[model samples]
Target: MALATSRFLPVLDCPDPRGLAAFYRDLLGWQVTQDSDDWVELSRDGYLALAFQLAPQFVPRAWPAEGVHSHIDVFVDDLDDAEREALRLGALRVDHPPTPQKFRVYRDPAGHHFCLCTT
Candidate 1:
């Protein structure tokens, strides 16, 4: 018999699981698949799922810091349109406007760095 392989799911830990889950829910238009005091799962069409977990000791990542995860990249079809929409949706613009390469970076309400790149 063949060994079963499972797909990987990206899990994010933060102080406020509900807040983080809402951010992603709005940003990605995903619906809440599961919710609890300590965790929440967001999914769309059963293909993409993102999990947010509550971590009492959660320490936000310092992207440019010496030993922290840099950032998460999200590819979009229209960089300008997406940036404008993201700003309207409460994302703080961390970097300057989109460059010629068609990418812009921003920070979520909880300080996680993410980028919008033209795909």
Candidate 2:
């Protein structure tokens, strides 16, 4: 048996919904499909991909620390170029020791961890 779904949206909680959404929007070149004070949604092509919800007392988890549940991994044609663009879009590099060979970790402006990876 399997569950059927129409759409799937992975939402991230941040202090500022629009701000966080903007960061991802710029990073991924996605369009803002919906926006409000406490929530924002982004779409790629024509499908909803990601969303951000306002968390008033949000405390971002530190890299290499406990409480990190999951993170986003983005595939790119060129890792160097993607890294440069991500940095320019307000992403901070998180150079943990013994970094992976296929990907590099980074923290978004809202402090959520993500990876820029190459195929």
Candidate 3:
């Protein structure tokens, strides 16, 4: 018999799961399937899933730092266009600018870092 393994769902740790979920909801145009103070789940196309869990001791990842547990990669159609859109949506540009490779790093309003890459 073969063992059944659970699929992977990217889980982000933050002080407020609902707030972070809302940010992602707006950013990715995903609908919130489940939401609460401690946890929130967002879904798109019924497959891609993103979740957030509350961490009272949640210390935001200090990327470009010594060591960090994890980071997220977001793919976009156009790096430059996406960067501008993110800026308009209250995301701060942590890096200088997008390269020809079509990726840029930015931090959300709450300071959670994520990348915007061309798809």
Candidate 4:
């Protein structure tokens, strides 16, 4: 049994929702399904969505730090090309040691950590 049944919508908190949303919109090529001053939603299909919510005092979690909640993993075909695109979109590469061969980590403009994974 499940308490609720629905598709997952990942929401990221950032200082500027629109700016963050634009970053992801360009990265994923998703359409802006909804928009507001403090929130924005992007979707490729109605079944799944990604959203950004304004958090004026948001403090981003540090990579390689404990007690972190979650991070996004974007799978792609080419690691080098994906890394290039993410960097072009204002993502800063996280260069900690012991990086896995199949994935590379990066931080978005708002400072949230995400991975460019190959699988």
lDDT per model vs. reference = 0.80, 0.89, 0.80, 0.88
- Candidate 1: list runs displaced more than 4 Å: 1-3, 67-70, 97-101
- lDDT-wise, the better of 2 and 4 is 2
Q: List the residue pairs that clash in candidate 1.
A: none
Residue runs of model 4 more than 4 Å from their true location after superposition: 96-100
| Per-model TM-score versus the true fold | 0.82, 0.91, 0.83, 0.91
Q: Model 3, 58: alpha-carbon shift in Å?
A: 1.1
Model 2 scores a C-alpha lDDT of 0.89
The better-scoring model by lDDT among 2 and 3 is 2
lDDT per residue (tens digit) for residues 1-103 in model 4? 8769667789999999999999999998888999999999999877669999999999987656653588889989998899889999999998653756689
- TM-score of candidate 3 to 2 decimals: 0.83
- Model 1's TM-score against the true structure: 0.82
How do the residues 9-41 of candidate 2 rate in per-residue lDDT, one tens digit apiece?
899999999999999999999999999999999
Instruction: Please give the distance, in angstroms, between residue 88's alpha carbon in candidate 1 and its true position after superposition.
Output: 2.6
